[model samples]
Target chain A: MTNVLNKAINEKPVTTGMLLALMAATAYGSSQFLAKQIVTEIAPPSVVATVGLFSGFVVLMGLSIGNLPKDRKAPKKAVVFLILSGIASSAGVTFLYTALELAPVVIVAPVSSVTPLISLSLAHIFLPKMESITAKTWVGAILVVAGVSLITIGSHI
Target chain B: MTQAIIFALLAALGWGTSAIFVRLGLQNLTATPGTAISLAVGTILIGIVAVTAHGPTAFNLNPNEFAWIVLLGVLNYVLGRYLNFNSVNLAGISRSAPLLASAPLVAVAMGILIGGETINSFILLGTLSIFGGVILVATGGGRG
Candidate 1:
């Protein structure tokens, strides 16, 4: 564990992937507030999701054109995972944007915050080797759930 | 409050799992294809549902509405999705998820500054608690 820590620390300041993730998280986190604003003007959650997905698809496709992996075509197995994941992603966004449409950003944001707990729990159940559920994790998970609940309570005001 | 909270919780669970699924799916394809394909699939599904429920013109909208939708979609979905997938790949979900969740605070600030929204006592307390709890969970990781 110490060695792993040292290796991670000693690595180059930041990798492109890590930078992208941080950017993505911040961008996503901010979207709650933005979506809340836009949904006020636009009524249907499906419309919001559809438009957003199409725009994102076009943008990503455009960006990816010159960067295609110089390797074999995407595996069929990967396509299946991508489809399943697409559903999950779409479902998440649908709920998120819909929630934003209905409530304040502050009220809606915390609910999505508990995502880690869910992912971790699901990972524990489905991918045991990848993640360990320790007592601390359970406690943290509980706190996230409870904290989100309180945020909901606050939203009623 | 309860209903809104429930909705948010539902959203969070979905978002959290979405992160996991993105990581899982990215393993199978190039980042670009993976992102585009995923969004395309989702958009199609959503389009079908909207059309079925509302009719063929479900997607019909004014240019102004379309602009906002497109911009938000690009910012949050395209840009955000790419960054997030990369972050998970780099930092791992443990660090990435918590930081990502901190976005509520950002929204709170934006709400105050732009939305002319005021935070009441309960909201103040709740927001503080949420941040405090997040700090605990994040720092508990023992690295940062």
Candidate 2:
């Protein structure tokens, strides 16, 4: 059992990564539906965001406590970036919950999923070495924007 | 409707930029600590907002609501985020990103099945186009 576990962990990173990504997407995607239900029943979007994030923080803190001593000495820059990232993500969650309150899950999910296009643009500008924007990427981005436009327009009609 | 779409786009922008920051920070920290710190920070920020907007009562959810919130936190923040960070570490953001973007597909299906969300051909077409575009961007074949 240990050898099997080790082999799975060590053998194929790309495959494992893809699988993990898929699983994450599924969990996150389904979350919108659940979130919609929660918001309808209880608190507002801000409260939901706060409670959910705090619960998550508690869980992650518990899980990470063992590594905290060694990891606490991270560079100041990384800490700053992570804090900023957290702020940004908090805003995202707030907006997402607001959107969910206003619209159906199907409509809100696809529209918000366009994060990749924005991420790609940011990567091109900030971290060129990390990701280079190609013609295909441009086309893809255009298609995504166009699709989002269509959905928005169509939903109104 | 327009308001909802705008808010959703804002969310996209926030999440998109957050990914870059996470990647940058991950350079110095591993997934576990990085996730813990970021989530803790985000929670505090959101908690502040919640307090200011709705007062301390904002945290006063019903027992069922609290349970649901806990479940959501576990599912999305703990499991979902852990997988996402690990995927980025392993596959690089460029490759793992589009796959992550595919979350909408799952959401749409689940929404219809569980949430009773109705879908039209327009929505179908839009989803297909978005998925196609995300794939193109992910496999852009650019210099790494």
Candidate 3:
């Protein structure tokens, strides 16, 4: 069992990665809906974000404790990046909950989905080796932006 | 409406850029540690905001609501984020991002079924457009 798990972790295939991404998306998307429900009862978006994140942090810390020593320490550069990323993530989630409080899940979820467009653009500019903005990427981004615009506009009227 | 849109856009920017950092960080740290550190930091930052905005009472909640929040934390932060880190580690941002973008589609469906959300033609159309765009981006103009 350990060997199989190790193989799965060490030799992740593209299909597995794609599957994981899909699952993550589904879980995240559902959480938005759930969060909308939670916020209706829980006041202050910050509170919701705090509780949810704190809970996850505790669980993840518990899970990582056993592996802490064996794992190679992250480089200083990576630690910096991770800290920045965590700040960004906190900002993103706080904003997301605030938006959910204001708008319906249908509207908020699609708009937030534009993360990839931004992600792709940022990757293209900063991490050129990580991602190249091809024509298809541009076209898709346009579509996503257009779609988000429609939803945003429609929500108002 | 305007406020919501602005905040949502801000979220898009934050989340989008964070993916890059995750990828970069994963290069040096394993997924579990990377997820733990990032989430821990995020939780602290957001917790501070919550406390500052609403006082310590901001953390207060009824039993039922607290239970739900815990469940959401597990589903989203633990399971979802762990998988997300793995995906980025395995597939890179360009390839995995579009797949993750499909979240809104799932949310729309789940919202309707569970949250009693009413969808209109525009919402449906917009959702489809976004999904199509994500697919196009993922497949690289239908190449594969």
Point to the candidate with the largest TM-score. Answer: 2
User: Over the stretch B66-118, how does candidate 3's per-residue lDDT look in tens digits?
Assistant: 88988888999888977897888887776787788788888888888888888
> Which prediction has more favorable DockQ, 1 or 2?
2
Cα lDDT tens digits, model 2, B1-144, are 889999999999998899899989989987777877888888888888888988997787678779999898889899998889788877777778878878889988988998888988887888888888888876783766
Q: Which one wins on DockQ?
A: 2
Tell me each candidate's TM-score.
Answer: 0.81, 0.90, 0.86
- Fnat per predicted structure, each in turn: 0.58, 0.79, 0.76
lDDT of 3 by residue, A23-108 (tens): 89989888999889888766678888888888888898899899887655657898888888999988999999999998888888
Q: Which ten residues in a row have the lowest lDDT in candidate 2 chain A?
A: A1-10
Stretches > 4 Å off in candidate 2:
A1-18, B85-99, B141-144
Score each candidate by Cα lDDT: 0.70, 0.86, 0.83
* Predicted structure 2, TM vs. truth: 0.90
Expressed as tens digits, the lDDT of each residue in A80-123 for candidate 2 is 99999999988999999999999988888888888878887988
Which 10-residue window of candidate 1 chain A scores lowest in summed lDDT?
A: A12-21
Which regions in candidate 3 have their CA more than 4 angstroms from the true location?
A1-22, A70-72, B83-100, B141-144
